[model samples]
Target chain A: MAQLSYRDAVARGIAQEMRRDERVVVVGEDIAGAGGVFKTTVGLLDEFGPKRVLDTPISEQAILGAAMGAAMTGLRPVAEIMFSDFFAVCWDIVVNQIAKTRYMTDGQVSLPLVIKTGNGGGLRFGAQHSQSIENWAMAVPGLKVVTPSTAEDVVGLMAAAIRDEDPVIFCEHKGLYASKGEVPDGEIVDSLGTAKIRRPGRDATILALGMMVPRALAAAEDLATRGIDAEVIDVRSLVPLDTRTILGSVARTGRLFTVEENPQLLGWGAEIASIVADEAFWDLDGPVQRITTPHIPLPSADSLEDLVMPSAESVASTVEKALQS
Target chain B: MKLPLSEHRYGEHGVVLPPERSDANDALDVDLDRRRQLYRSMREMRTFEKRAYDLFMKQLVKGTSHLSLGMEAIAAGFGAAMREDDYTFATYRGHAHTLARGVPMTPVLAELLGRANGLMGGKGGSMHLTSVEHGMMGSYAIIGAHLTIANGAAWSAQYRGSGQVAVCFFGDGTTNIGAFHEALNYAAVYRLPVVFVCENNLYMEYTSIHDITAVPHPAADRAPAYGLESIVIDGNDADEVHLAAVTALDRARSGQGPSLVEALTYRHGGHSRADPGKYRPSEEVEAWKAYDPLTVYRERLVRLGVSEDELDAIDASVLALVDAATEGAIAGELPSPESAFTDVWADGGWSWRN
Candidate 1:
């Protein structure tokens, strides 16, 4: 195993897929010659050449439309939307066309494509650039949504997403781009709809997604020192949620807490909280708690941004107070 | 919110129209068999649409359907010009384009009735017709979106050295949509094999396209900005459309990049079954109806040395085909309840759980 940054893992994963399947191609703004604006797709243009790696203009609809059309005809295209916030510019392509085409065509056509975007806040990119809009994609019926917190999951999940028959929204967090983690050397393809039990415990269950996974783990470490054992679960894929892992953890701890970076209203955690309330009602020792950014646009100030998003300290305090009471 | 209407935007001559190319077929070069095929395609489309109108009157048609009542020549012309492997992406008023791809009338009609034997097993309804086997890629209901999607198909063809062109057909109003311009610029930049066909049928639903649009010819006028040739043709004449389609198709197939063609025609009927088009003046309707594509094409066939007896035979056969298809479509049963739960995912199940 070698330690790789989360951004480098994205390039590694795409290179693996492109080398394996000739049909795989990448299209986005500055993704080809420039190696992507975030530098997540470096070394791809040199390895795969311009034929496999393409750079397009700032037309989100064109980028996605070309990707959708290519997928329908026969080419596995991995397109980028720059920032998750820019999905609004071409939501018609995402929400109405790409997401609905397979089912609307009644399975005659399948789109095996991936739309990777820089998602979430804390980098001070302000409101337009940094919103955790996984909930937006999750609301659509025919889309697969996943966000990886670690480099290993990034390489593995991107492979799984590109190989899947459906369209996947791969939300790569900008906040975790510089973070490092160990990734297996050869091809590593993980499964979708499966959650990883980051930290196993017995007192209470903590569920987190994307960048929140690492924070939740840190929160678990913080709570352990306070004598409150916490089980931290990484909710990797949202559409095909691993209820087996979540429900099993809930049953063991009899208490649930969701740590989310998304805004409060209709956050992904809201859905999990609802699910736990319905299925694990008898298993609960207290009310299900959701620690999330309040329903407001992300601000650019470091202190203000930190105040809005759920942190390791906030999660620790929330879980401790709930478990102790 | 209400906006003031200019005096130039109100009467029989409210919309500025393209000049008629009355001699569009002066030097047209189509052989005997090809002419018959074009005539037959337009006839089949006309019959299918009339049958759909009848079914709607009977309350048997499932949902809102847009028809190509007088726009058959555009579909027939491009469909004829396109190679068998070439892709077609059309708008919601796509029954003609779908039929032009040689998809049989029975399943197409059945799909309109929401029947089990329908093309999509009654899931897509009248708007979203798609047959991947025949290369009728999809019929998008939303305006301007498919133009961008068509670029992808063309881009894929270019990448794989398939030598296939994607012919995307949409109404004139689609030019104003944000995606239309983006798609044009994208296709030209990559030199992808795509042809954008705008069926300028004078109206954008109820509003006159010319009044709302900055330019008289919405699509062709925008071509220079994208470095494509601006082309406008007589859509009522199959010969004119076929010749133009061939030029554009050849341009795209040979990697000369994309071409934009605006076909000038008039909708004889309203936009959909729900509209009677009382908004259009009777004189204007009558004047336009005189240039009916099928009638004019049949007359043109006689002038081109094809006898009336041969034309009559083709017409009789088309009527019989439509009659049989209507009967077959009516005989199909409602889709099973279990079908609703299927096809939501590639696994043929709608499970979102682990």
Candidate 2:
């Protein structure tokens, strides 16, 4: 096993897929020679050359639209949107065009492409730049939303997204770019909708995604010290959700809490909460709780941003108070 | 291992020049056989669109449909100019473009009728007509977006060493949108083989394109900004558009980069089935109808010594084909209730759970 950072894992994943398939190509603004603004796609241009790793104008619609068109013709494209919030500029390409192309064309054209974006709110880039839009992608019908919490998952899920014969919204948290984890040396690939039980416990089920996973695990650790055992499940892929694992966990632990970086009201947690309420209602000992940023535009100030977004300390305290109550 | 770069395939046919002044009666490179084929394509598209309008008028076609009633020449020209493997991305007014790619009329008609035998099995109606096997990639309902998509197809062709050219068709309104400029710049920067054809049909939906647009020729006027020559032509003249299409296609296939051609035409009908088109001045409509593509082409053929009987025979045959397509479409069955659940993913199922 090799220790790799989250950002390096992204480049590794893309390179692995590109090496395997001649049809694979990557395109985005500053993703080629500049190695991407977040530095996740470093070395792709030199490795694959300019033909495969293309640097496009600062056009989100162009980046995604080209990716969709390329995928329609014949190419496994991984197009980056720079920032997840920029999907607003070209949401039509993503939600209406790419997401619905396969179903709309009656499977005549399958878009084997991945939309990689730096997602989440921890970097303090403010409201426009930093927003976890996975919930926005999940709301779409024909899209597969994937958020990898670890370096290994970053490589594996990205590989899976590129290989899959459908458009995948792969959200790489801006906060976890520097985070490191042990990744198996050779090619690594993981399924889209499988949740990993990071820390298994019996008292409560703590569901998290992207940057929230680490904090949830840390909170679980804090809860363990206080005699409140918490189970942390990294909810990797939202659309093809691992309901079996979630339901099974909820069944074991009568309490459920979702840790999410997205703002409250229609966050991914609400959907999970709704599901647990309907299916695992009988297994629940108390009402489901969602720990998320308040329903407000994220502030860039470090203290205010830290206060708004959920952290390990906040998660631990919330879980402790909820379990005690 | 990395893939090798592609070399140019269209060696002899280099840059294709537009008519010096956008005249209809420019010196033509077309022969009688080519003219006859172009005439057939135009006739087929014309017949298909007329039948589609008739169906919409009868309330048989559900939802809404955008018809290319008077915009047949542009589709015919590009469809003829493109190879069998070339890709086409058109707007919602795509029935003609779809038919031009040689997709049979029956399935297209059936799709409008929302039948199981439809092109997309009734999943995609008139607004989303697509036949990838025929190289008609898709008919995007949203404006300006397909331009960028065409660039991607071109990029793929360039990457894979394929000489296929991607042609995108949109209306005059799209030229004002950001994606149009973005796509043009991108295509030029990367030197991707793509042709952007703007059917400047005088209107952008309900609004007059001239009123909202900043430039005179919506697409061609802005071509120079992206290092492309601004070429405008009489869309009513099939030969003129055909020549322009050949030029752009050659330029793209030969690795000369992208072209933006503005084909000036007017739609005989409203944007969609919903509009009665009272907003258009009667005299303006009358003047444009007088210069209709089919009428102009028919006159040109006659002036070139083609017999009246031959043209009549072609039109009659086209009408008969449209009739058969309509009959078959009317008889086509509705999609099975369970069929809607399929094709949501590559697994051919809609399940989102493990």
Candidate 3:
């Protein structure tokens, strides 16, 4: 095991995959000589050379389209979109081409490509840069959405995303880039569609993703002090959702509170809440609560951004209200 | 409508076809067998498309189908020039392109019919036909989208030292899209081995290209901007298209970077089955019909010592093949409802139902 930051873990995962397979390539803007904007792809160019680590023009449509094409051929491409907000620019390539290619081709081709983009609203990057758009990815059918919370999970999940045959959108939170945690030194591949129980409890189950995972964990700790045992579940994969784990936790706790950094209306949290309500409605002791950002663009001011986003206090308060009901 | 004596034409719009070399006489040095094969492929595509048009008119084929009635020469030429392993990508009007790439006629016909035996298992209809085994990468419905994808394929070939080139076929309208420029820029910068073939069929759907685009020569005029070598070919002449494709593919394979080939042609049919092409001028249509690729090629073949009976026999054979394929595809079974859930993911664990 080794202590690594989330960014470093991502770089290590990509590096390891590239080392193992010559067909694996990394392509993005400024990912070559300058490392990535977030330094997530640092040292890749020097290690893999220019052939594998290609620095492309500032065209998301071209980058994604090329990556899809390469994936169609024989290359396992890992493309970075700089920020998840820019996915809108390449929306056609992702939704129309990438998502539909496999199903449209009837299993004739497999797109073993990873689209790594920074997501979430923290660090005051303003409206354009700081939107957590995991909901958009989850809404797409063919795409596998992975949002790892910790450095260790990033390592495992990134490895798995690189190996997945389907196109995987790895939504790395910009807030979690600097966060440090222990990651396994060797090969670690986590299975997609599995949720990890961070803090096991019985009072209420808290399902969180990306940055919300740490906040949920903190809220669970705070709830423990108040004589309430809150179970915290980190939802790593959003598409092939680990519904079994969430349902089992909800059955044990009899209460559910889903948390995410995205907007409240039609967010990924709502999908989880609806699933729990439909599958385990009778088992729920109270109505499912969702703690998410307000349906407004994230502002540049830190205070306003904080107000819009969910915090540990907010998660704890939501849990308290659910328990009181 | 008569064949020009000079073998070169420079229009006021900057469209230029270079004069034929004196060293090359009668069919650009292509052997008789290859010429016969090209003629057969073009005839097959033409017959198949006409039959498909009738099927569409009868409401037998589901959804809208785009027919390349006047653009078979480009597909046949590129298909003949490209090696079996080289990848090919095209726009929605890609039935001829796919057929010329050597994909079996049954699956393509079945796909248009939306049967279980279709190329994409009835999932991808006429617009999205793809056969990876034959290097027919995909036929994208979206304009200019597949150019960058083709660049990626070229990059893969370059990276793996696979000695393979990727050919992207699009229309003049596609050249105006942002992806077209982006793809060309990247292909030039990376020196990727890709050939961008523009089938300038004078119209983009119901609208004329002149009304939409400011540039007269879309491919040639734009090639220099992206640092690409450009050529203009007589699209109606299969021999000219084949020679141009060979030159471009050779430059790509030799690591000379990407090039653009603008094949000036016209679509005899409408953009899709729903379109009647009432917007087209009657005189323009008549003028183009006189230069129909099949008719022109047939006359050239007869002049090149191929008997009239032999050409008729070839046409009959092509008609028979298309008939067999159509009958088999129409008789094929419909896909099970359960199959709609399959092939979405490779792992096979997740289903659309969940």
The top-ranked prediction according to DockQ is: 1
Model 3, runs deviating above 4 Å: B1-27, B349-354
Q: What is the interface root-mean-square deviation of candidate 3?
A: 1.7
Point out the higher-scoring one by lDDT: 1 or 3: 1
Best of the two (1, 3) by DockQ: 1
If the candidates were sorted by their DockQ against the true structure, best first, what order would they fall in?
Answer: 1, 2, 3
Q: Please, what are the lDDT tens digits per residue for candidate 2 over residues A1-325?
A: 9899999999999999999998999988899999999898899999889888888889999999999988988899999999999999999999889988889889898899999999998887999999999999999899999999999999999999999998999999999999999999898999999999999999999999999999999999988989999999999999799999999999999999999899998999999899888898999999899999999999999889999999999999998999899
Docking class of 2: high
Task: Rate residue A303 of model 2 by lDDT.
Answer: 89
Tens-digit per-residue lDDT, A1-325, candidate 3: 8899999988998998888888899999999998999999999999989988988899999899999999999899999999999999888899889988888888888899999999987899899999998899889889989899999888889889998899999999999999999987788888877889999998999999999999999999999999899999998888788888989999999999989899888998898888888999999988888888888888999999988799999999888866776
* Candidate 1 per-residue C-alpha lDDT over B146-225 given as tens digits, one digit per residue, 9 for 90 to 100: 99999999999999999999999999889998999999999999999999999988889888887789986789889889
For candidate 1, the TM-score is: 0.97
Whole-model Cα lDDT of every candidate shown, in order: 0.90, 0.89, 0.88
Better of 2 and 3 by DockQ: 2
**Residue by residue across B262-350, what tens digits does model 2's lDDT show?**
88778999988898787777766776677677877887788778899999999999999999999999999999999899999999989
Q: How many backbone clashes does candidate 1 have?
A: 1
* Candidate number of the best TM-score: 1
